[model samples]
Target: MTELLWYGLIINERTVVNMKKKYFLLALLLLVLVFSLTGCVPGDGANNEEHLAGFFWGIWHGWIAPISLIIGIFKDNIRIYEINNIGWWYDLGFYIAVISGFGGLSLSRRRKK
Candidate 1:
């Protein structure tokens, strides 16, 4: 659809409008994906720093787990989970975020509403 528009091939106004809407939706979705997958702020290699990435950070990282995982494959520095977390609470937040981000979405889509 977009290819046709790019090549100056779309002749009908209706087709162009429809394609524009589709492209807009596609762009919006891409934007959401990019933002959702945003990783944490990089830290220095210092060993004695306080780990602020607790529950909130865990939720954010977990929500973007899928994207982070993909990026992790290419980059070594980028990690899905914090190396030094506070404890089980961090794990709790990550699991909650994962379930909400993935499973919750699936559940929502299943309803007609």
Candidate 2:
């Protein structure tokens, strides 16, 4: 682009749009490559082992579950509950987290006019 300006060549709007599309595609390709290279789950038999990640961890992770879901799309071993859990307790924490995180907004008190 600078070279074009230096050469006194006019850049068209179509050219700018094409450049943006190329950059978007490049970034998407890079992300796919990166996510494909990493296995998010640990190799210590996480599928069979349940180490009780506990309530606090469950709450924290659940708060960020949407992010984990996106990452899980590329990795095979990663999951919301597969990373060591205390079964229903973890679920309880997750439910609590999700409810508090989103439901609290809906439950907000309104001031009387």
Candidate 3:
């Protein structure tokens, strides 16, 4: 009858709404998990006392910064930047790479006029 059809439609709408809510919660949970597990931190020590990291190492580190950050979070030996470096040159290269690598991501987006 008409009443039964209305009831079925209402139930279907409720089910759809519930499904949306579930997906939203799942996405939120995944975001929280990802953010909680990844981050950057400075590191310093005599781990590489014999051979200090130079400009090239800085560039390499900057290029792999994201991965290093994640690994650094879980491992004590891994760090985003090297403390025992050649100072200015190392810093310059690190900054250059970090800036360019991250800035490049913005270029991939198409602008709407």
Report RMSD (Å) for each prediction in the order shown.
Answer: 6.5, 8.2, 8.0
TM-score of each: 0.62, 0.48, 0.55
Q: Which 10-residue window of candidate 3 scores lowest in summed lDDT? A: 38-47
Q: For candidate 3, lDDT tens digit of each residue in 1-113?
A: 12225545644566667889999999999898665534332354532667677787677678767877777778887788888787899898898889889997897889999
Candidate 1 lDDT, 1-113, residue by residue in tens:
23345466755767778879999999999998686556352221221246456787678778777776777777776667776667788799999988888888788776567
The alpha-carbon deviation from the true structure for residue 23 of candidate 1, after best TM-score superposition, in angstroms, is: 1.0
**Candidates' C-alpha lDDT:** 0.69, 0.65, 0.72
Ranking by TM-score: 1, 3, 2
Highest lDDT: which candidate?
A: 3
lDDT of 2 at 56: 70
C-alpha lDDT of candidate 1 relative to the true structure: 0.69
Task: Kindly list the per-residue Cα lDDT of model 2 for residues 1-113, writing each as its tens digit.
Answer: 33244367667777788889999999999898666433333222433454556677567666766656666687665665545677787778878987897788788968689
Ranking by lDDT: 3, 1, 2
Q: Global CA lDDT of candidate 2, please?
A: 0.65
